[model samples]
Target: MTFTQNRLSSERLAQVSAGSRFSYNRTQQAIGIVHFGIGAFHRAHQAWYTDRAMDAGDRNWATCGVSLRSKNVADQLTPQDGLYTVAERSERGTHLCVVGAVQEVLVHPRDCNAIIERLSSPDTHIASFTVTEKGYCRSADGSLDPDRAGAGSIYDYLTRGLALRKERGLSGLTLLSCDNLADNGRQLERLLKAYCAENDAQLGEWIATNCTFPCTMVDRIVPATTDADRTDIMEILQVQDEAAVVTESFTQWVIEDKFAGPRPAWEQVGAEIVSDVAPYETAKLRMLNGAHSALAYLGLKAGYTFVHEAIGDPALRSLVEQLMREEAAPTVATADGQSLPSYAEALIARFANPALQHKLIQIGMDGSQKIPQRWLETLEANRTAGRQCPAIIAAMKAWFAHLRGDNGPVEDPMADRLTEIASRTSDAQCAVALFGEGGMMPRIWQVSEEKLQALFS
Candidate 1:
């Protein structure tokens, strides 16, 4: 029972009543280029850019979105016929975009051969990623993580991909990491090489010689899935999309122009291709993400449940703004050629958007994963250049205080992790003590620790 002369799956048949059936007029497929760690951000940012490029590139840029961790993506996307709607939840209103650029979905364990097959394609132009900071196998010192004891993701993915590529003789694919980590591409290459060296040296050299990893800085506030989003998306697009992604009205991607093969005109799709993404990336991390994490840890402590709520509260709002304007902006460059003062103002305005309802817990999750990429790297850079990092320090100290389960007027620790952290630390001093005990922090952290201790204590 189709409403519009279309062949539809039962789910889409029910959800999207009107649309034509597949006439085998398939859109363009790319040269086996696969993106690792496909998530909400990838769908909203990278895939959006790629889709626009593919449409303009005359179908020369199709993507096979690869999920190394979940069957959720496959289950949601496969049923929808690989189609979903992206909703830009904005201050003014909601904007909907139906994306058809992702031609296929492959789960790592289930579709190993398919992933390799995509990479081996000679025409495969670029393999991009936004796997978050933890996805890269960097250690405390910011080089590749050496120990593979717990079977780290960075090691596992590269280990399998390199071994498969060698067996299949697939050469010269670009690995572009769009996470917030500093020197992201170089670190990614090191991780891949580390995996190869441990298992096979020749493979390491092959990866070193053939594969190129490009660093990138991406910005966007894409919240987790919500039921209302599902309903609204269904109402507007009239589609039953389980893997649909929702994000804020804003988005930005700044990538270093270094790729192994043919790439997308990301610039055509409102992305920036720059000589060095460092300044831009650093600015975003400090201004946007650093501010974000600061809000998450501190705001949650201040008894505010959501990011918007915290921003609305006078005290928390002051804390967020002061850190950004007074402490953070002096140290970094702004995107769109905006002044630091203006950038902070915009960020405050964006953060305070009442409609977005971005959750603090979402930003707060996986601090072990986020800080090295988002916060500490910027702090290290500032310190190295003989620049001051007082704002970053205050944010860090505030974060540490948060870990200790104590805030002055509002003493609220996130309920879920309380038991585990309590077991780990008896008090705030002990909590602070854990930083040097073979943790993710290193010498630069040591340099900043004294300053942070003074602020919190």
Candidate 2:
């Protein structure tokens, strides 16, 4: 039997494993959080945490997931009543738990106006975002990109929704960003304010006075669900779940203690509510995300698909460790009393988790948007301090090589620009051209052309 609303019941659940189904009353859950980008990561991280909180009596945090672009997630989960299984894998074993966090879903074009209406409602106290870096539609300096706005991006949609909210005189909501960008909440606020100011000054003033944007850092290794994962779910529960999410048995969320209104008691369930999320955000970006990108490009070049396969290779793992320890850590401040050494050790072990087949190419996507925070800022800081980062230079070279049809087909907003840079010869001269004066990366390109060429050489 397949899992669906009609098929799920107390009697049916009794026949299944204890941890495989939610024991609580699903009927009582109501939507409070309106989440953009209903993807695997959200389902595995935020939704999971919210579901646990609801199960533990904090029932006001049920999510109404909205799919901004793709209808695939809605298509898969809506039929199941937004109830999907999360298979947590680790070296010890695997455990399955059904997540009932998202009680309703809205797919764009199907219910575009409804999404806006729901967001404008006073019940929706949080408009959370996990729409990736490019989804913000911002330029290098964090302002709203005129070109992206012209194309009717998320920024346009958000501005329109806020205008509607202002017209309705609804209370302001906290806009939370769970993406892997530095000061993500601040960036979203900047873009939204820029869009609103250009469209309606009065609305912009309302947002500035009413709304709050809180920066957050989320950590988990959630791989895209494969057919094998679905098969395993069927074998375990005698039911097919198309929307099952697979991930490692670890989770962390660091959130700034800033909100426009009341929020979930997420701190009750291991979330670190801090006054400032800058140090934690910077540490994860430079160490974990930067290392992941390094592994993705270098791993792809070495003909490996999974992260474990890349880390299992002693040489590649050593290079990654060296990059983390010798290069990336120096630029990132310590966080939560955890030294870089222990953090790097834990990351290395997490990456080598064979149970979760996290793909390399997935992490390597949208390098143009991802690279600025992951490596560029750190590279600039290191160079300004009169330090050289050979490992970062190597990773940058891998990205350039990856862009030029080396790893696979490129998927980036700046794909054409990357192709243009990659068109030059595959030598240190090309490196010089790409990172030198008048190239794409101005921050890291601050070094002399000779020095850039030398690093690549």
TM-scores of the candidates are 0.84, 0.94
Q: Per-residue alpha-carbon lDDT of model 1 for 303-331, expressed as tens digits?
A: 77778888888877787777677556666
The C-alpha local distance difference test score for the whole of candidate 1 amounts to: 0.67
lDDT of each: 0.67, 0.83
Query: lDDT for model 2, on a 0 to 1 scale?
Result: 0.83
Over 4 Å off in model 2, which ranges?
Answer: 1-15, 140-142, 150-152, 427-433, 442-445
Best-fitting candidate, scored by TM-score? 2
Which lDDT value does model 1 have at 363? Answer: 82
TM accuracy, model 1:
0.84
